[model samples]
Target chain A: MIVFTMLNDRFILATNLSLMTQQTVIVGTLAIAQTLIILTAGIDLSIGAIMVFAQMTMANLVVTSEVSNVAGYGWPAALAIAAGILIAMVAGGVNGFLIVRFELPPFIVTLGTLSIFTALTLIFFKARTIQGPEMPDAMTWMGTTFKLGPFTVMTGVLVMLAMYGIFAFILRNTAWGTHIYAVGDDPDAAELSGISTGRVLFSVYCVAGLIIGIAAWITIGRVGSASPNVAPNINLDSITAVVIGGTSLFGGRGTMIGTLLGALIVVVFQNGLALAGYDQAPRVLAVGVLVIAAVALDQWIRKVQG
Target chain B: MSTVPAILSGRGLVKHFGRVVGLNGADIDLFPGEVLAVIGDNGAGKSTLIKCFSGAHAPDTGTMEVTGQDVLFRSTHEARLAGIETVFQTLAVSPALDIAENLYLGREIRKQGVLGTAFRMLDRKRMRAEAGQRLQDLGIGTIQNISQAVETLSGGQRQAVAVARAAAFGSKVIILDEPTAALGVRESARVLQLIHDLRERGMPVILISHNMPQVFEVADRIHVQRLGKRAAVVTPSKFDMKDAVAIMTGALEVDEADQALGPVRTPAAV
Candidate 1:
């Protein structure tokens, strides 16, 4: 109530609220993917790097010389997008394969991959940004806005929501979802009960990679550019959203609804702070405080319930 | 007792864990409609033997036969497919999931149409109903809510869920590793009764336990393991608790004279 009162006092209008929802697209989609990884007690620090790499792949494939107009065929925007997503999935597969086959820790694996992918992005794109006419219509289509009853919503926002809805169903009412929770809860026990823990973990990484690919597309649309430097803090931000949404960092306990709400809370906090005349430094500080408080509250809840 | 062939058997099973002998040439046989109690002192290779049968660990050297067919299991899923199910001491359940979900953790029932084949949706309603029925069948009526998370249940209830899961899915054989080690007296009795019920249904059961009275109360035949090998296989009517304990701890040895006494007319003194 106090925050709402402050926002109202600052004359924050409905348009600002709609824009805040729109702003949630990129981070929100990434959070969904992060939720899946975290549910297995795993973390991916290379999510931001993967998304940026995928976006660059999509953009450069469309703009490069003979690559765009190959074999007497016009530039294929759809092929570029598919290739970008496929690359992201392969990257995700690599992470899963190494982790599962070798039994390596997810944190260290993703940490190493983060540096590797960032270097690849730099080498491939030369740290250049693709903007304006260089981006094809198919690539920028998600950025277009559609008006709905006194509010303008971005297509990208709808796509994010759809991803959340589809995955929420899959997690709730599918055998694969139960297997995921089982593996996260107890890998040895799951294996004894006839679940292949390696297979489940490997598939989770691959699926999360596919989601990150979609997040990359959203990043391109939201920023109106495919820049190697985009979403530098997304890996941490997605983790924040997932943790704030009531998913345990230790894994095997969380909900996608909580994640969506978590993403929204982070966005709302930043937007509200900016509206209330706080600088960028204070906004970042507030988010830091919120993350700590949310986790502390989660610990308290666990103890109380026990 | 019915002259039925051994449904599952292992011979010359051996497993070593970095200089610690898990199993040293342990052999086991389970007949139909009988409870074969495997009792041993701590580190007597009881767990190692069952693990070999349940596919948790591959024996360094051994041969396993299920229904007279030679088989090698590289994974527990394969063991389950071959009609061998194990209820581990840890219960092997996801506590955060509901009772129904835990019951169908790996082998969930799916919808019949495109919703299942294409969309991969589960038949939650049917699963819940069947899980409820399975619990009731095992006389686990205390769990009023089938949808309740396993973490919220008591220790005995958790054990019941594990036993019920094994009994429902286990076809030829069910191996239980210390099913009542963590339960209260009443809970242990309930689990013992479930074991009896499984035997009555003619399903072979391999029960690994340290409790003497429970073993004497249920086992049709006792397999004493000592120093990572099967010391002797005797009936409850032939050798009493003292002899079983003496053999398991290696304080007493089984010679040809005792083997020739056919049911051992007199109980041997420790």
Candidate 2:
């Protein structure tokens, strides 16, 4: 009985580790879209706003949009995803237009849109939070308890892994991926090589918006409600994961695997610190230190190679 | 002596930067299995002509033909489709990427899945192997690893890789602008040999240079540009560096103005 109990204790610890791992993966997928945007030598300060906007839009659609005439559960779910993604695309598209067409610096453009998108999100909710429908029996299956051996995994985890895999494939295999790297490295040079830098930037922002939609889906499923004010520090965390993952903020010098590793590091450290009773101040300090260290290490590696 | 449609030919090419004439009524024929050197002082429209051929800017006037077919290229991709690749003086390579990755930067070959899905990603193994082989074929056996990023390569070696990429991608006509302008004597000589080797493989090469010795060394024919027009096409056997300079600076024509001032400038596209 003692031996069996020991084995069960060990199994529980392992399961907890796996659960943390799943959460890190979820965070990593959200960071990836941002990583890509940064890789193009551009910044998307509005990622947080975009993510929240997607969540609020989808939550309202599912709950308040009433199961009126024709469309039912299946249709609502699909339409919610589609609408969330579409809204994000339009938001991202506006960002793209301001940057590409107006010839404005991406930093200023995104900074302005960051405020605009947040305001838009608040407008959607009428300055109030949206409570998503009580997890439907079928929809609840996605949020159902998952077990891999002794470890429980959420649907969010699986979806994150799948998205990461897709991202890795797209970055590695497709011509579009090549164009992304090309545009990020040197827009003028890439243009000379026949890669449309503006188009690449536009597409990246559009894809970024789509990823926000996916993130919203996962967030709603995880929390069972959409609050615009939730996780105010998420944007910073996402950026921290991306930078620590080894994707250069300067662009054209990062990997999805690196970013995933980075996200895991960020989450694992934060969770472990929390488990050990560290305060929020120390956690924030560590993340800031991590960003600096990653950037310095990258520059050192580049210099050494030279 | 032999005809192959000049590989790439520009007729009546005109480009203007809002009244500042970059290239005005210029024409040039780049022949395969030969090096045609374009030489002039600054503002002779050499860069403009090269850019037009490379699809950087659409010519405001004139036609570009490749392999004898009139092509209207709006972008470099169009020029690439017609097997015309240009190695700009800036090199335009991603120093962050490895040698092989840079070589296959745009035209990466891969496996396809059912219904045209991308299954096998970037055939990297094959690319590395082929990149090695191609480099060796171009007489570049000194590179230890194709995976080493280009930032690690020497100036001459980077230029070699750039040229090798253009050559490997099936560029029938390779246009290089001042490729060795920044290299030292030994490095420049090494680059010149690569240019010569390119010709031996039946690929037409356009070598744009300011160095007369270097130009006379590799070029089979030298086309001298004087004030946005090609004034002379002289073979290496009958070339005079001083006379070429005089033509390039329009000094020869100025000297002849006292004797007879006529449009004797044939405007030949060599």
CA shift of A124, model 2, Å: 2.4
Which digits, one per residue and each the tens of the lDDT, describe model 1 over residues B3-112?
A: 44577888999999999999999888876667889999999999999988888889999899998998888888889999998999888998889999989888999999
lDDT tens digits, residue span A107-196, model 2: 899889889988998775655554445434333334555777877887777788788888988887666787788788877767766677
* lDDT tens digits by residue: candidate 2, B147-217: 98887899988898888878787567888999999898888888899888877766778889999999989
Q: How well does model 2 score by local distance difference test?
A: 0.76
- Fnat for each model: 0.93, 0.44
Q: DockQ of all candidates, in order?
A: 0.81, 0.44
Task: Kindly list the per-residue Cα lDDT of model 1 for residues A148-218, writing each as its tens digit.
Answer: 88788899999999999999999998889988888888888888889999999999999999999988888
Q: How many residue pairs clash in each candidate?
A: 0, 0
Where does model 2 exceed 4 Å of error? A1-19, A22-26, A65-75, A132-143, A148-150, B1-7, B112-120, B254-270
